[model samples]
Target: MAFKLPVHCPSCETMLSVSQLSCPECSTVVSGNYDLPLFLQLTRDEQDFIMQFILNSGSLKEMAAQMGNSYPTVRNKLDDIIGKINQLKNKNGKDDD
Candidate 1:
C-alpha cells in the first residue's frame, strides 16, 4: 500500500519540514529538521503525472493517450512541473537530487 506524505501544515500555508524518521523493523527512530525534496514538495497530482510519464517511457504523447489529454496539455503540465522544480532548487540554493 502507498501512503501519502503530508508536505504542508493544514492550518497554515507555510512549507513543512521533516523532523523524524523511524525504522519499522528495529524500532529505531532518528530525528532532525529536514526540508522536503523538490519532488515531494510538488502537489500529489503532479507526482502522479510524473510517475505516469516515467511509466510511459518519457513520452508525452503516450502519457496524453493514457491520461486522455491532448499532447500539448500534457507537455504543458510537464513544463509547469519543471518550472516549479527550478524554483524549488533556486529557493534551496541546492539541487534536491
Candidate 2:
C-alpha cells in the first residue's frame, strides 16, 4: 500500500523535512533538508476540497450541492483557503525580502 507523504512528525507533531531521496533504477541517493510546497502544507481535507472545487469547474454552487452545504458555507471554506494561501505567500515574500 502506498502511504501519504507525512508533513509533520508522527510522534511529536513537529514539522518534518525531506532528508533523502533514492533513484529506483540507478540506486543513486541524495540527502538534504527539503521544504514542502505551500499547497502540501494544507490539511488533507483542505486539499480534497480544492480538488473538488477544481472538478466542479470552480463553481461554488456545485461544490455546495455536492458537499450538502449552503453556497455561503462553501464560499466561506474557499475564503479560508484563500486566506491561508495569501498568508503563506506574504510570509514567503517577507522571507525573500
Candidate 3:
C-alpha cells in the first residue's frame, strides 16, 4: 500500500483530504489535485538515502561506501529523486498560473 499523509482543518477540526486547500475559515472548498510536501512525499528508502547523502556532505562515493552500493546506483537514485522534486515543483507552479 502506498503511504499517505493526514491533513486536518484548523477551523472545524475536521480531517481533510490530501487535495484540500482551504479551511472552514474561508467557507470555500478549494479544488484540484494537491501534492504532499517534497520531503514528506519521498519513500522511506529515498529518505534514508538522502539522509546518508547529506551526512556524507554530498559525496556520492562516500554514500555508496556507506550504503554498500555502487556509485552508479547511488547517483541514479539521487537523480531520480531530484527529477521527481523538480517535476513536482514545475507542476505546482503551473497549477498556480
State the C-alpha lDDT per candidate. Answer: 0.90, 0.87, 0.73
Residues 1-97, model 3: lDDT tens digits: 9755544457985534466667778688877765556565556777787888888999999988877999999899999998876775685564331
Please report the candidate that would top lDDT against the real structure.
1
Residue clash pairs of candidate 2: none
User: Model 1, range 1-97, lDDT digits (tens) per residue?
Assistant: 9887778898897889999999999999999999887888899999998998888899999888888999999999999999998998999899656
> What are the models' TM-scores?
0.90, 0.81, 0.58
At residue 18, candidate 2 shows an lDDT of 78
The regions of model 2 sitting more than 4 angstroms off are 92-97
Model 2 reaches what TM-score against the true structure?
Answer: 0.81
- TM-score winner between candidates 1 and 3: 1
Full-model lDDT, candidate 3: 0.73
Q: Give the TM-score of candidate 3.
A: 0.58
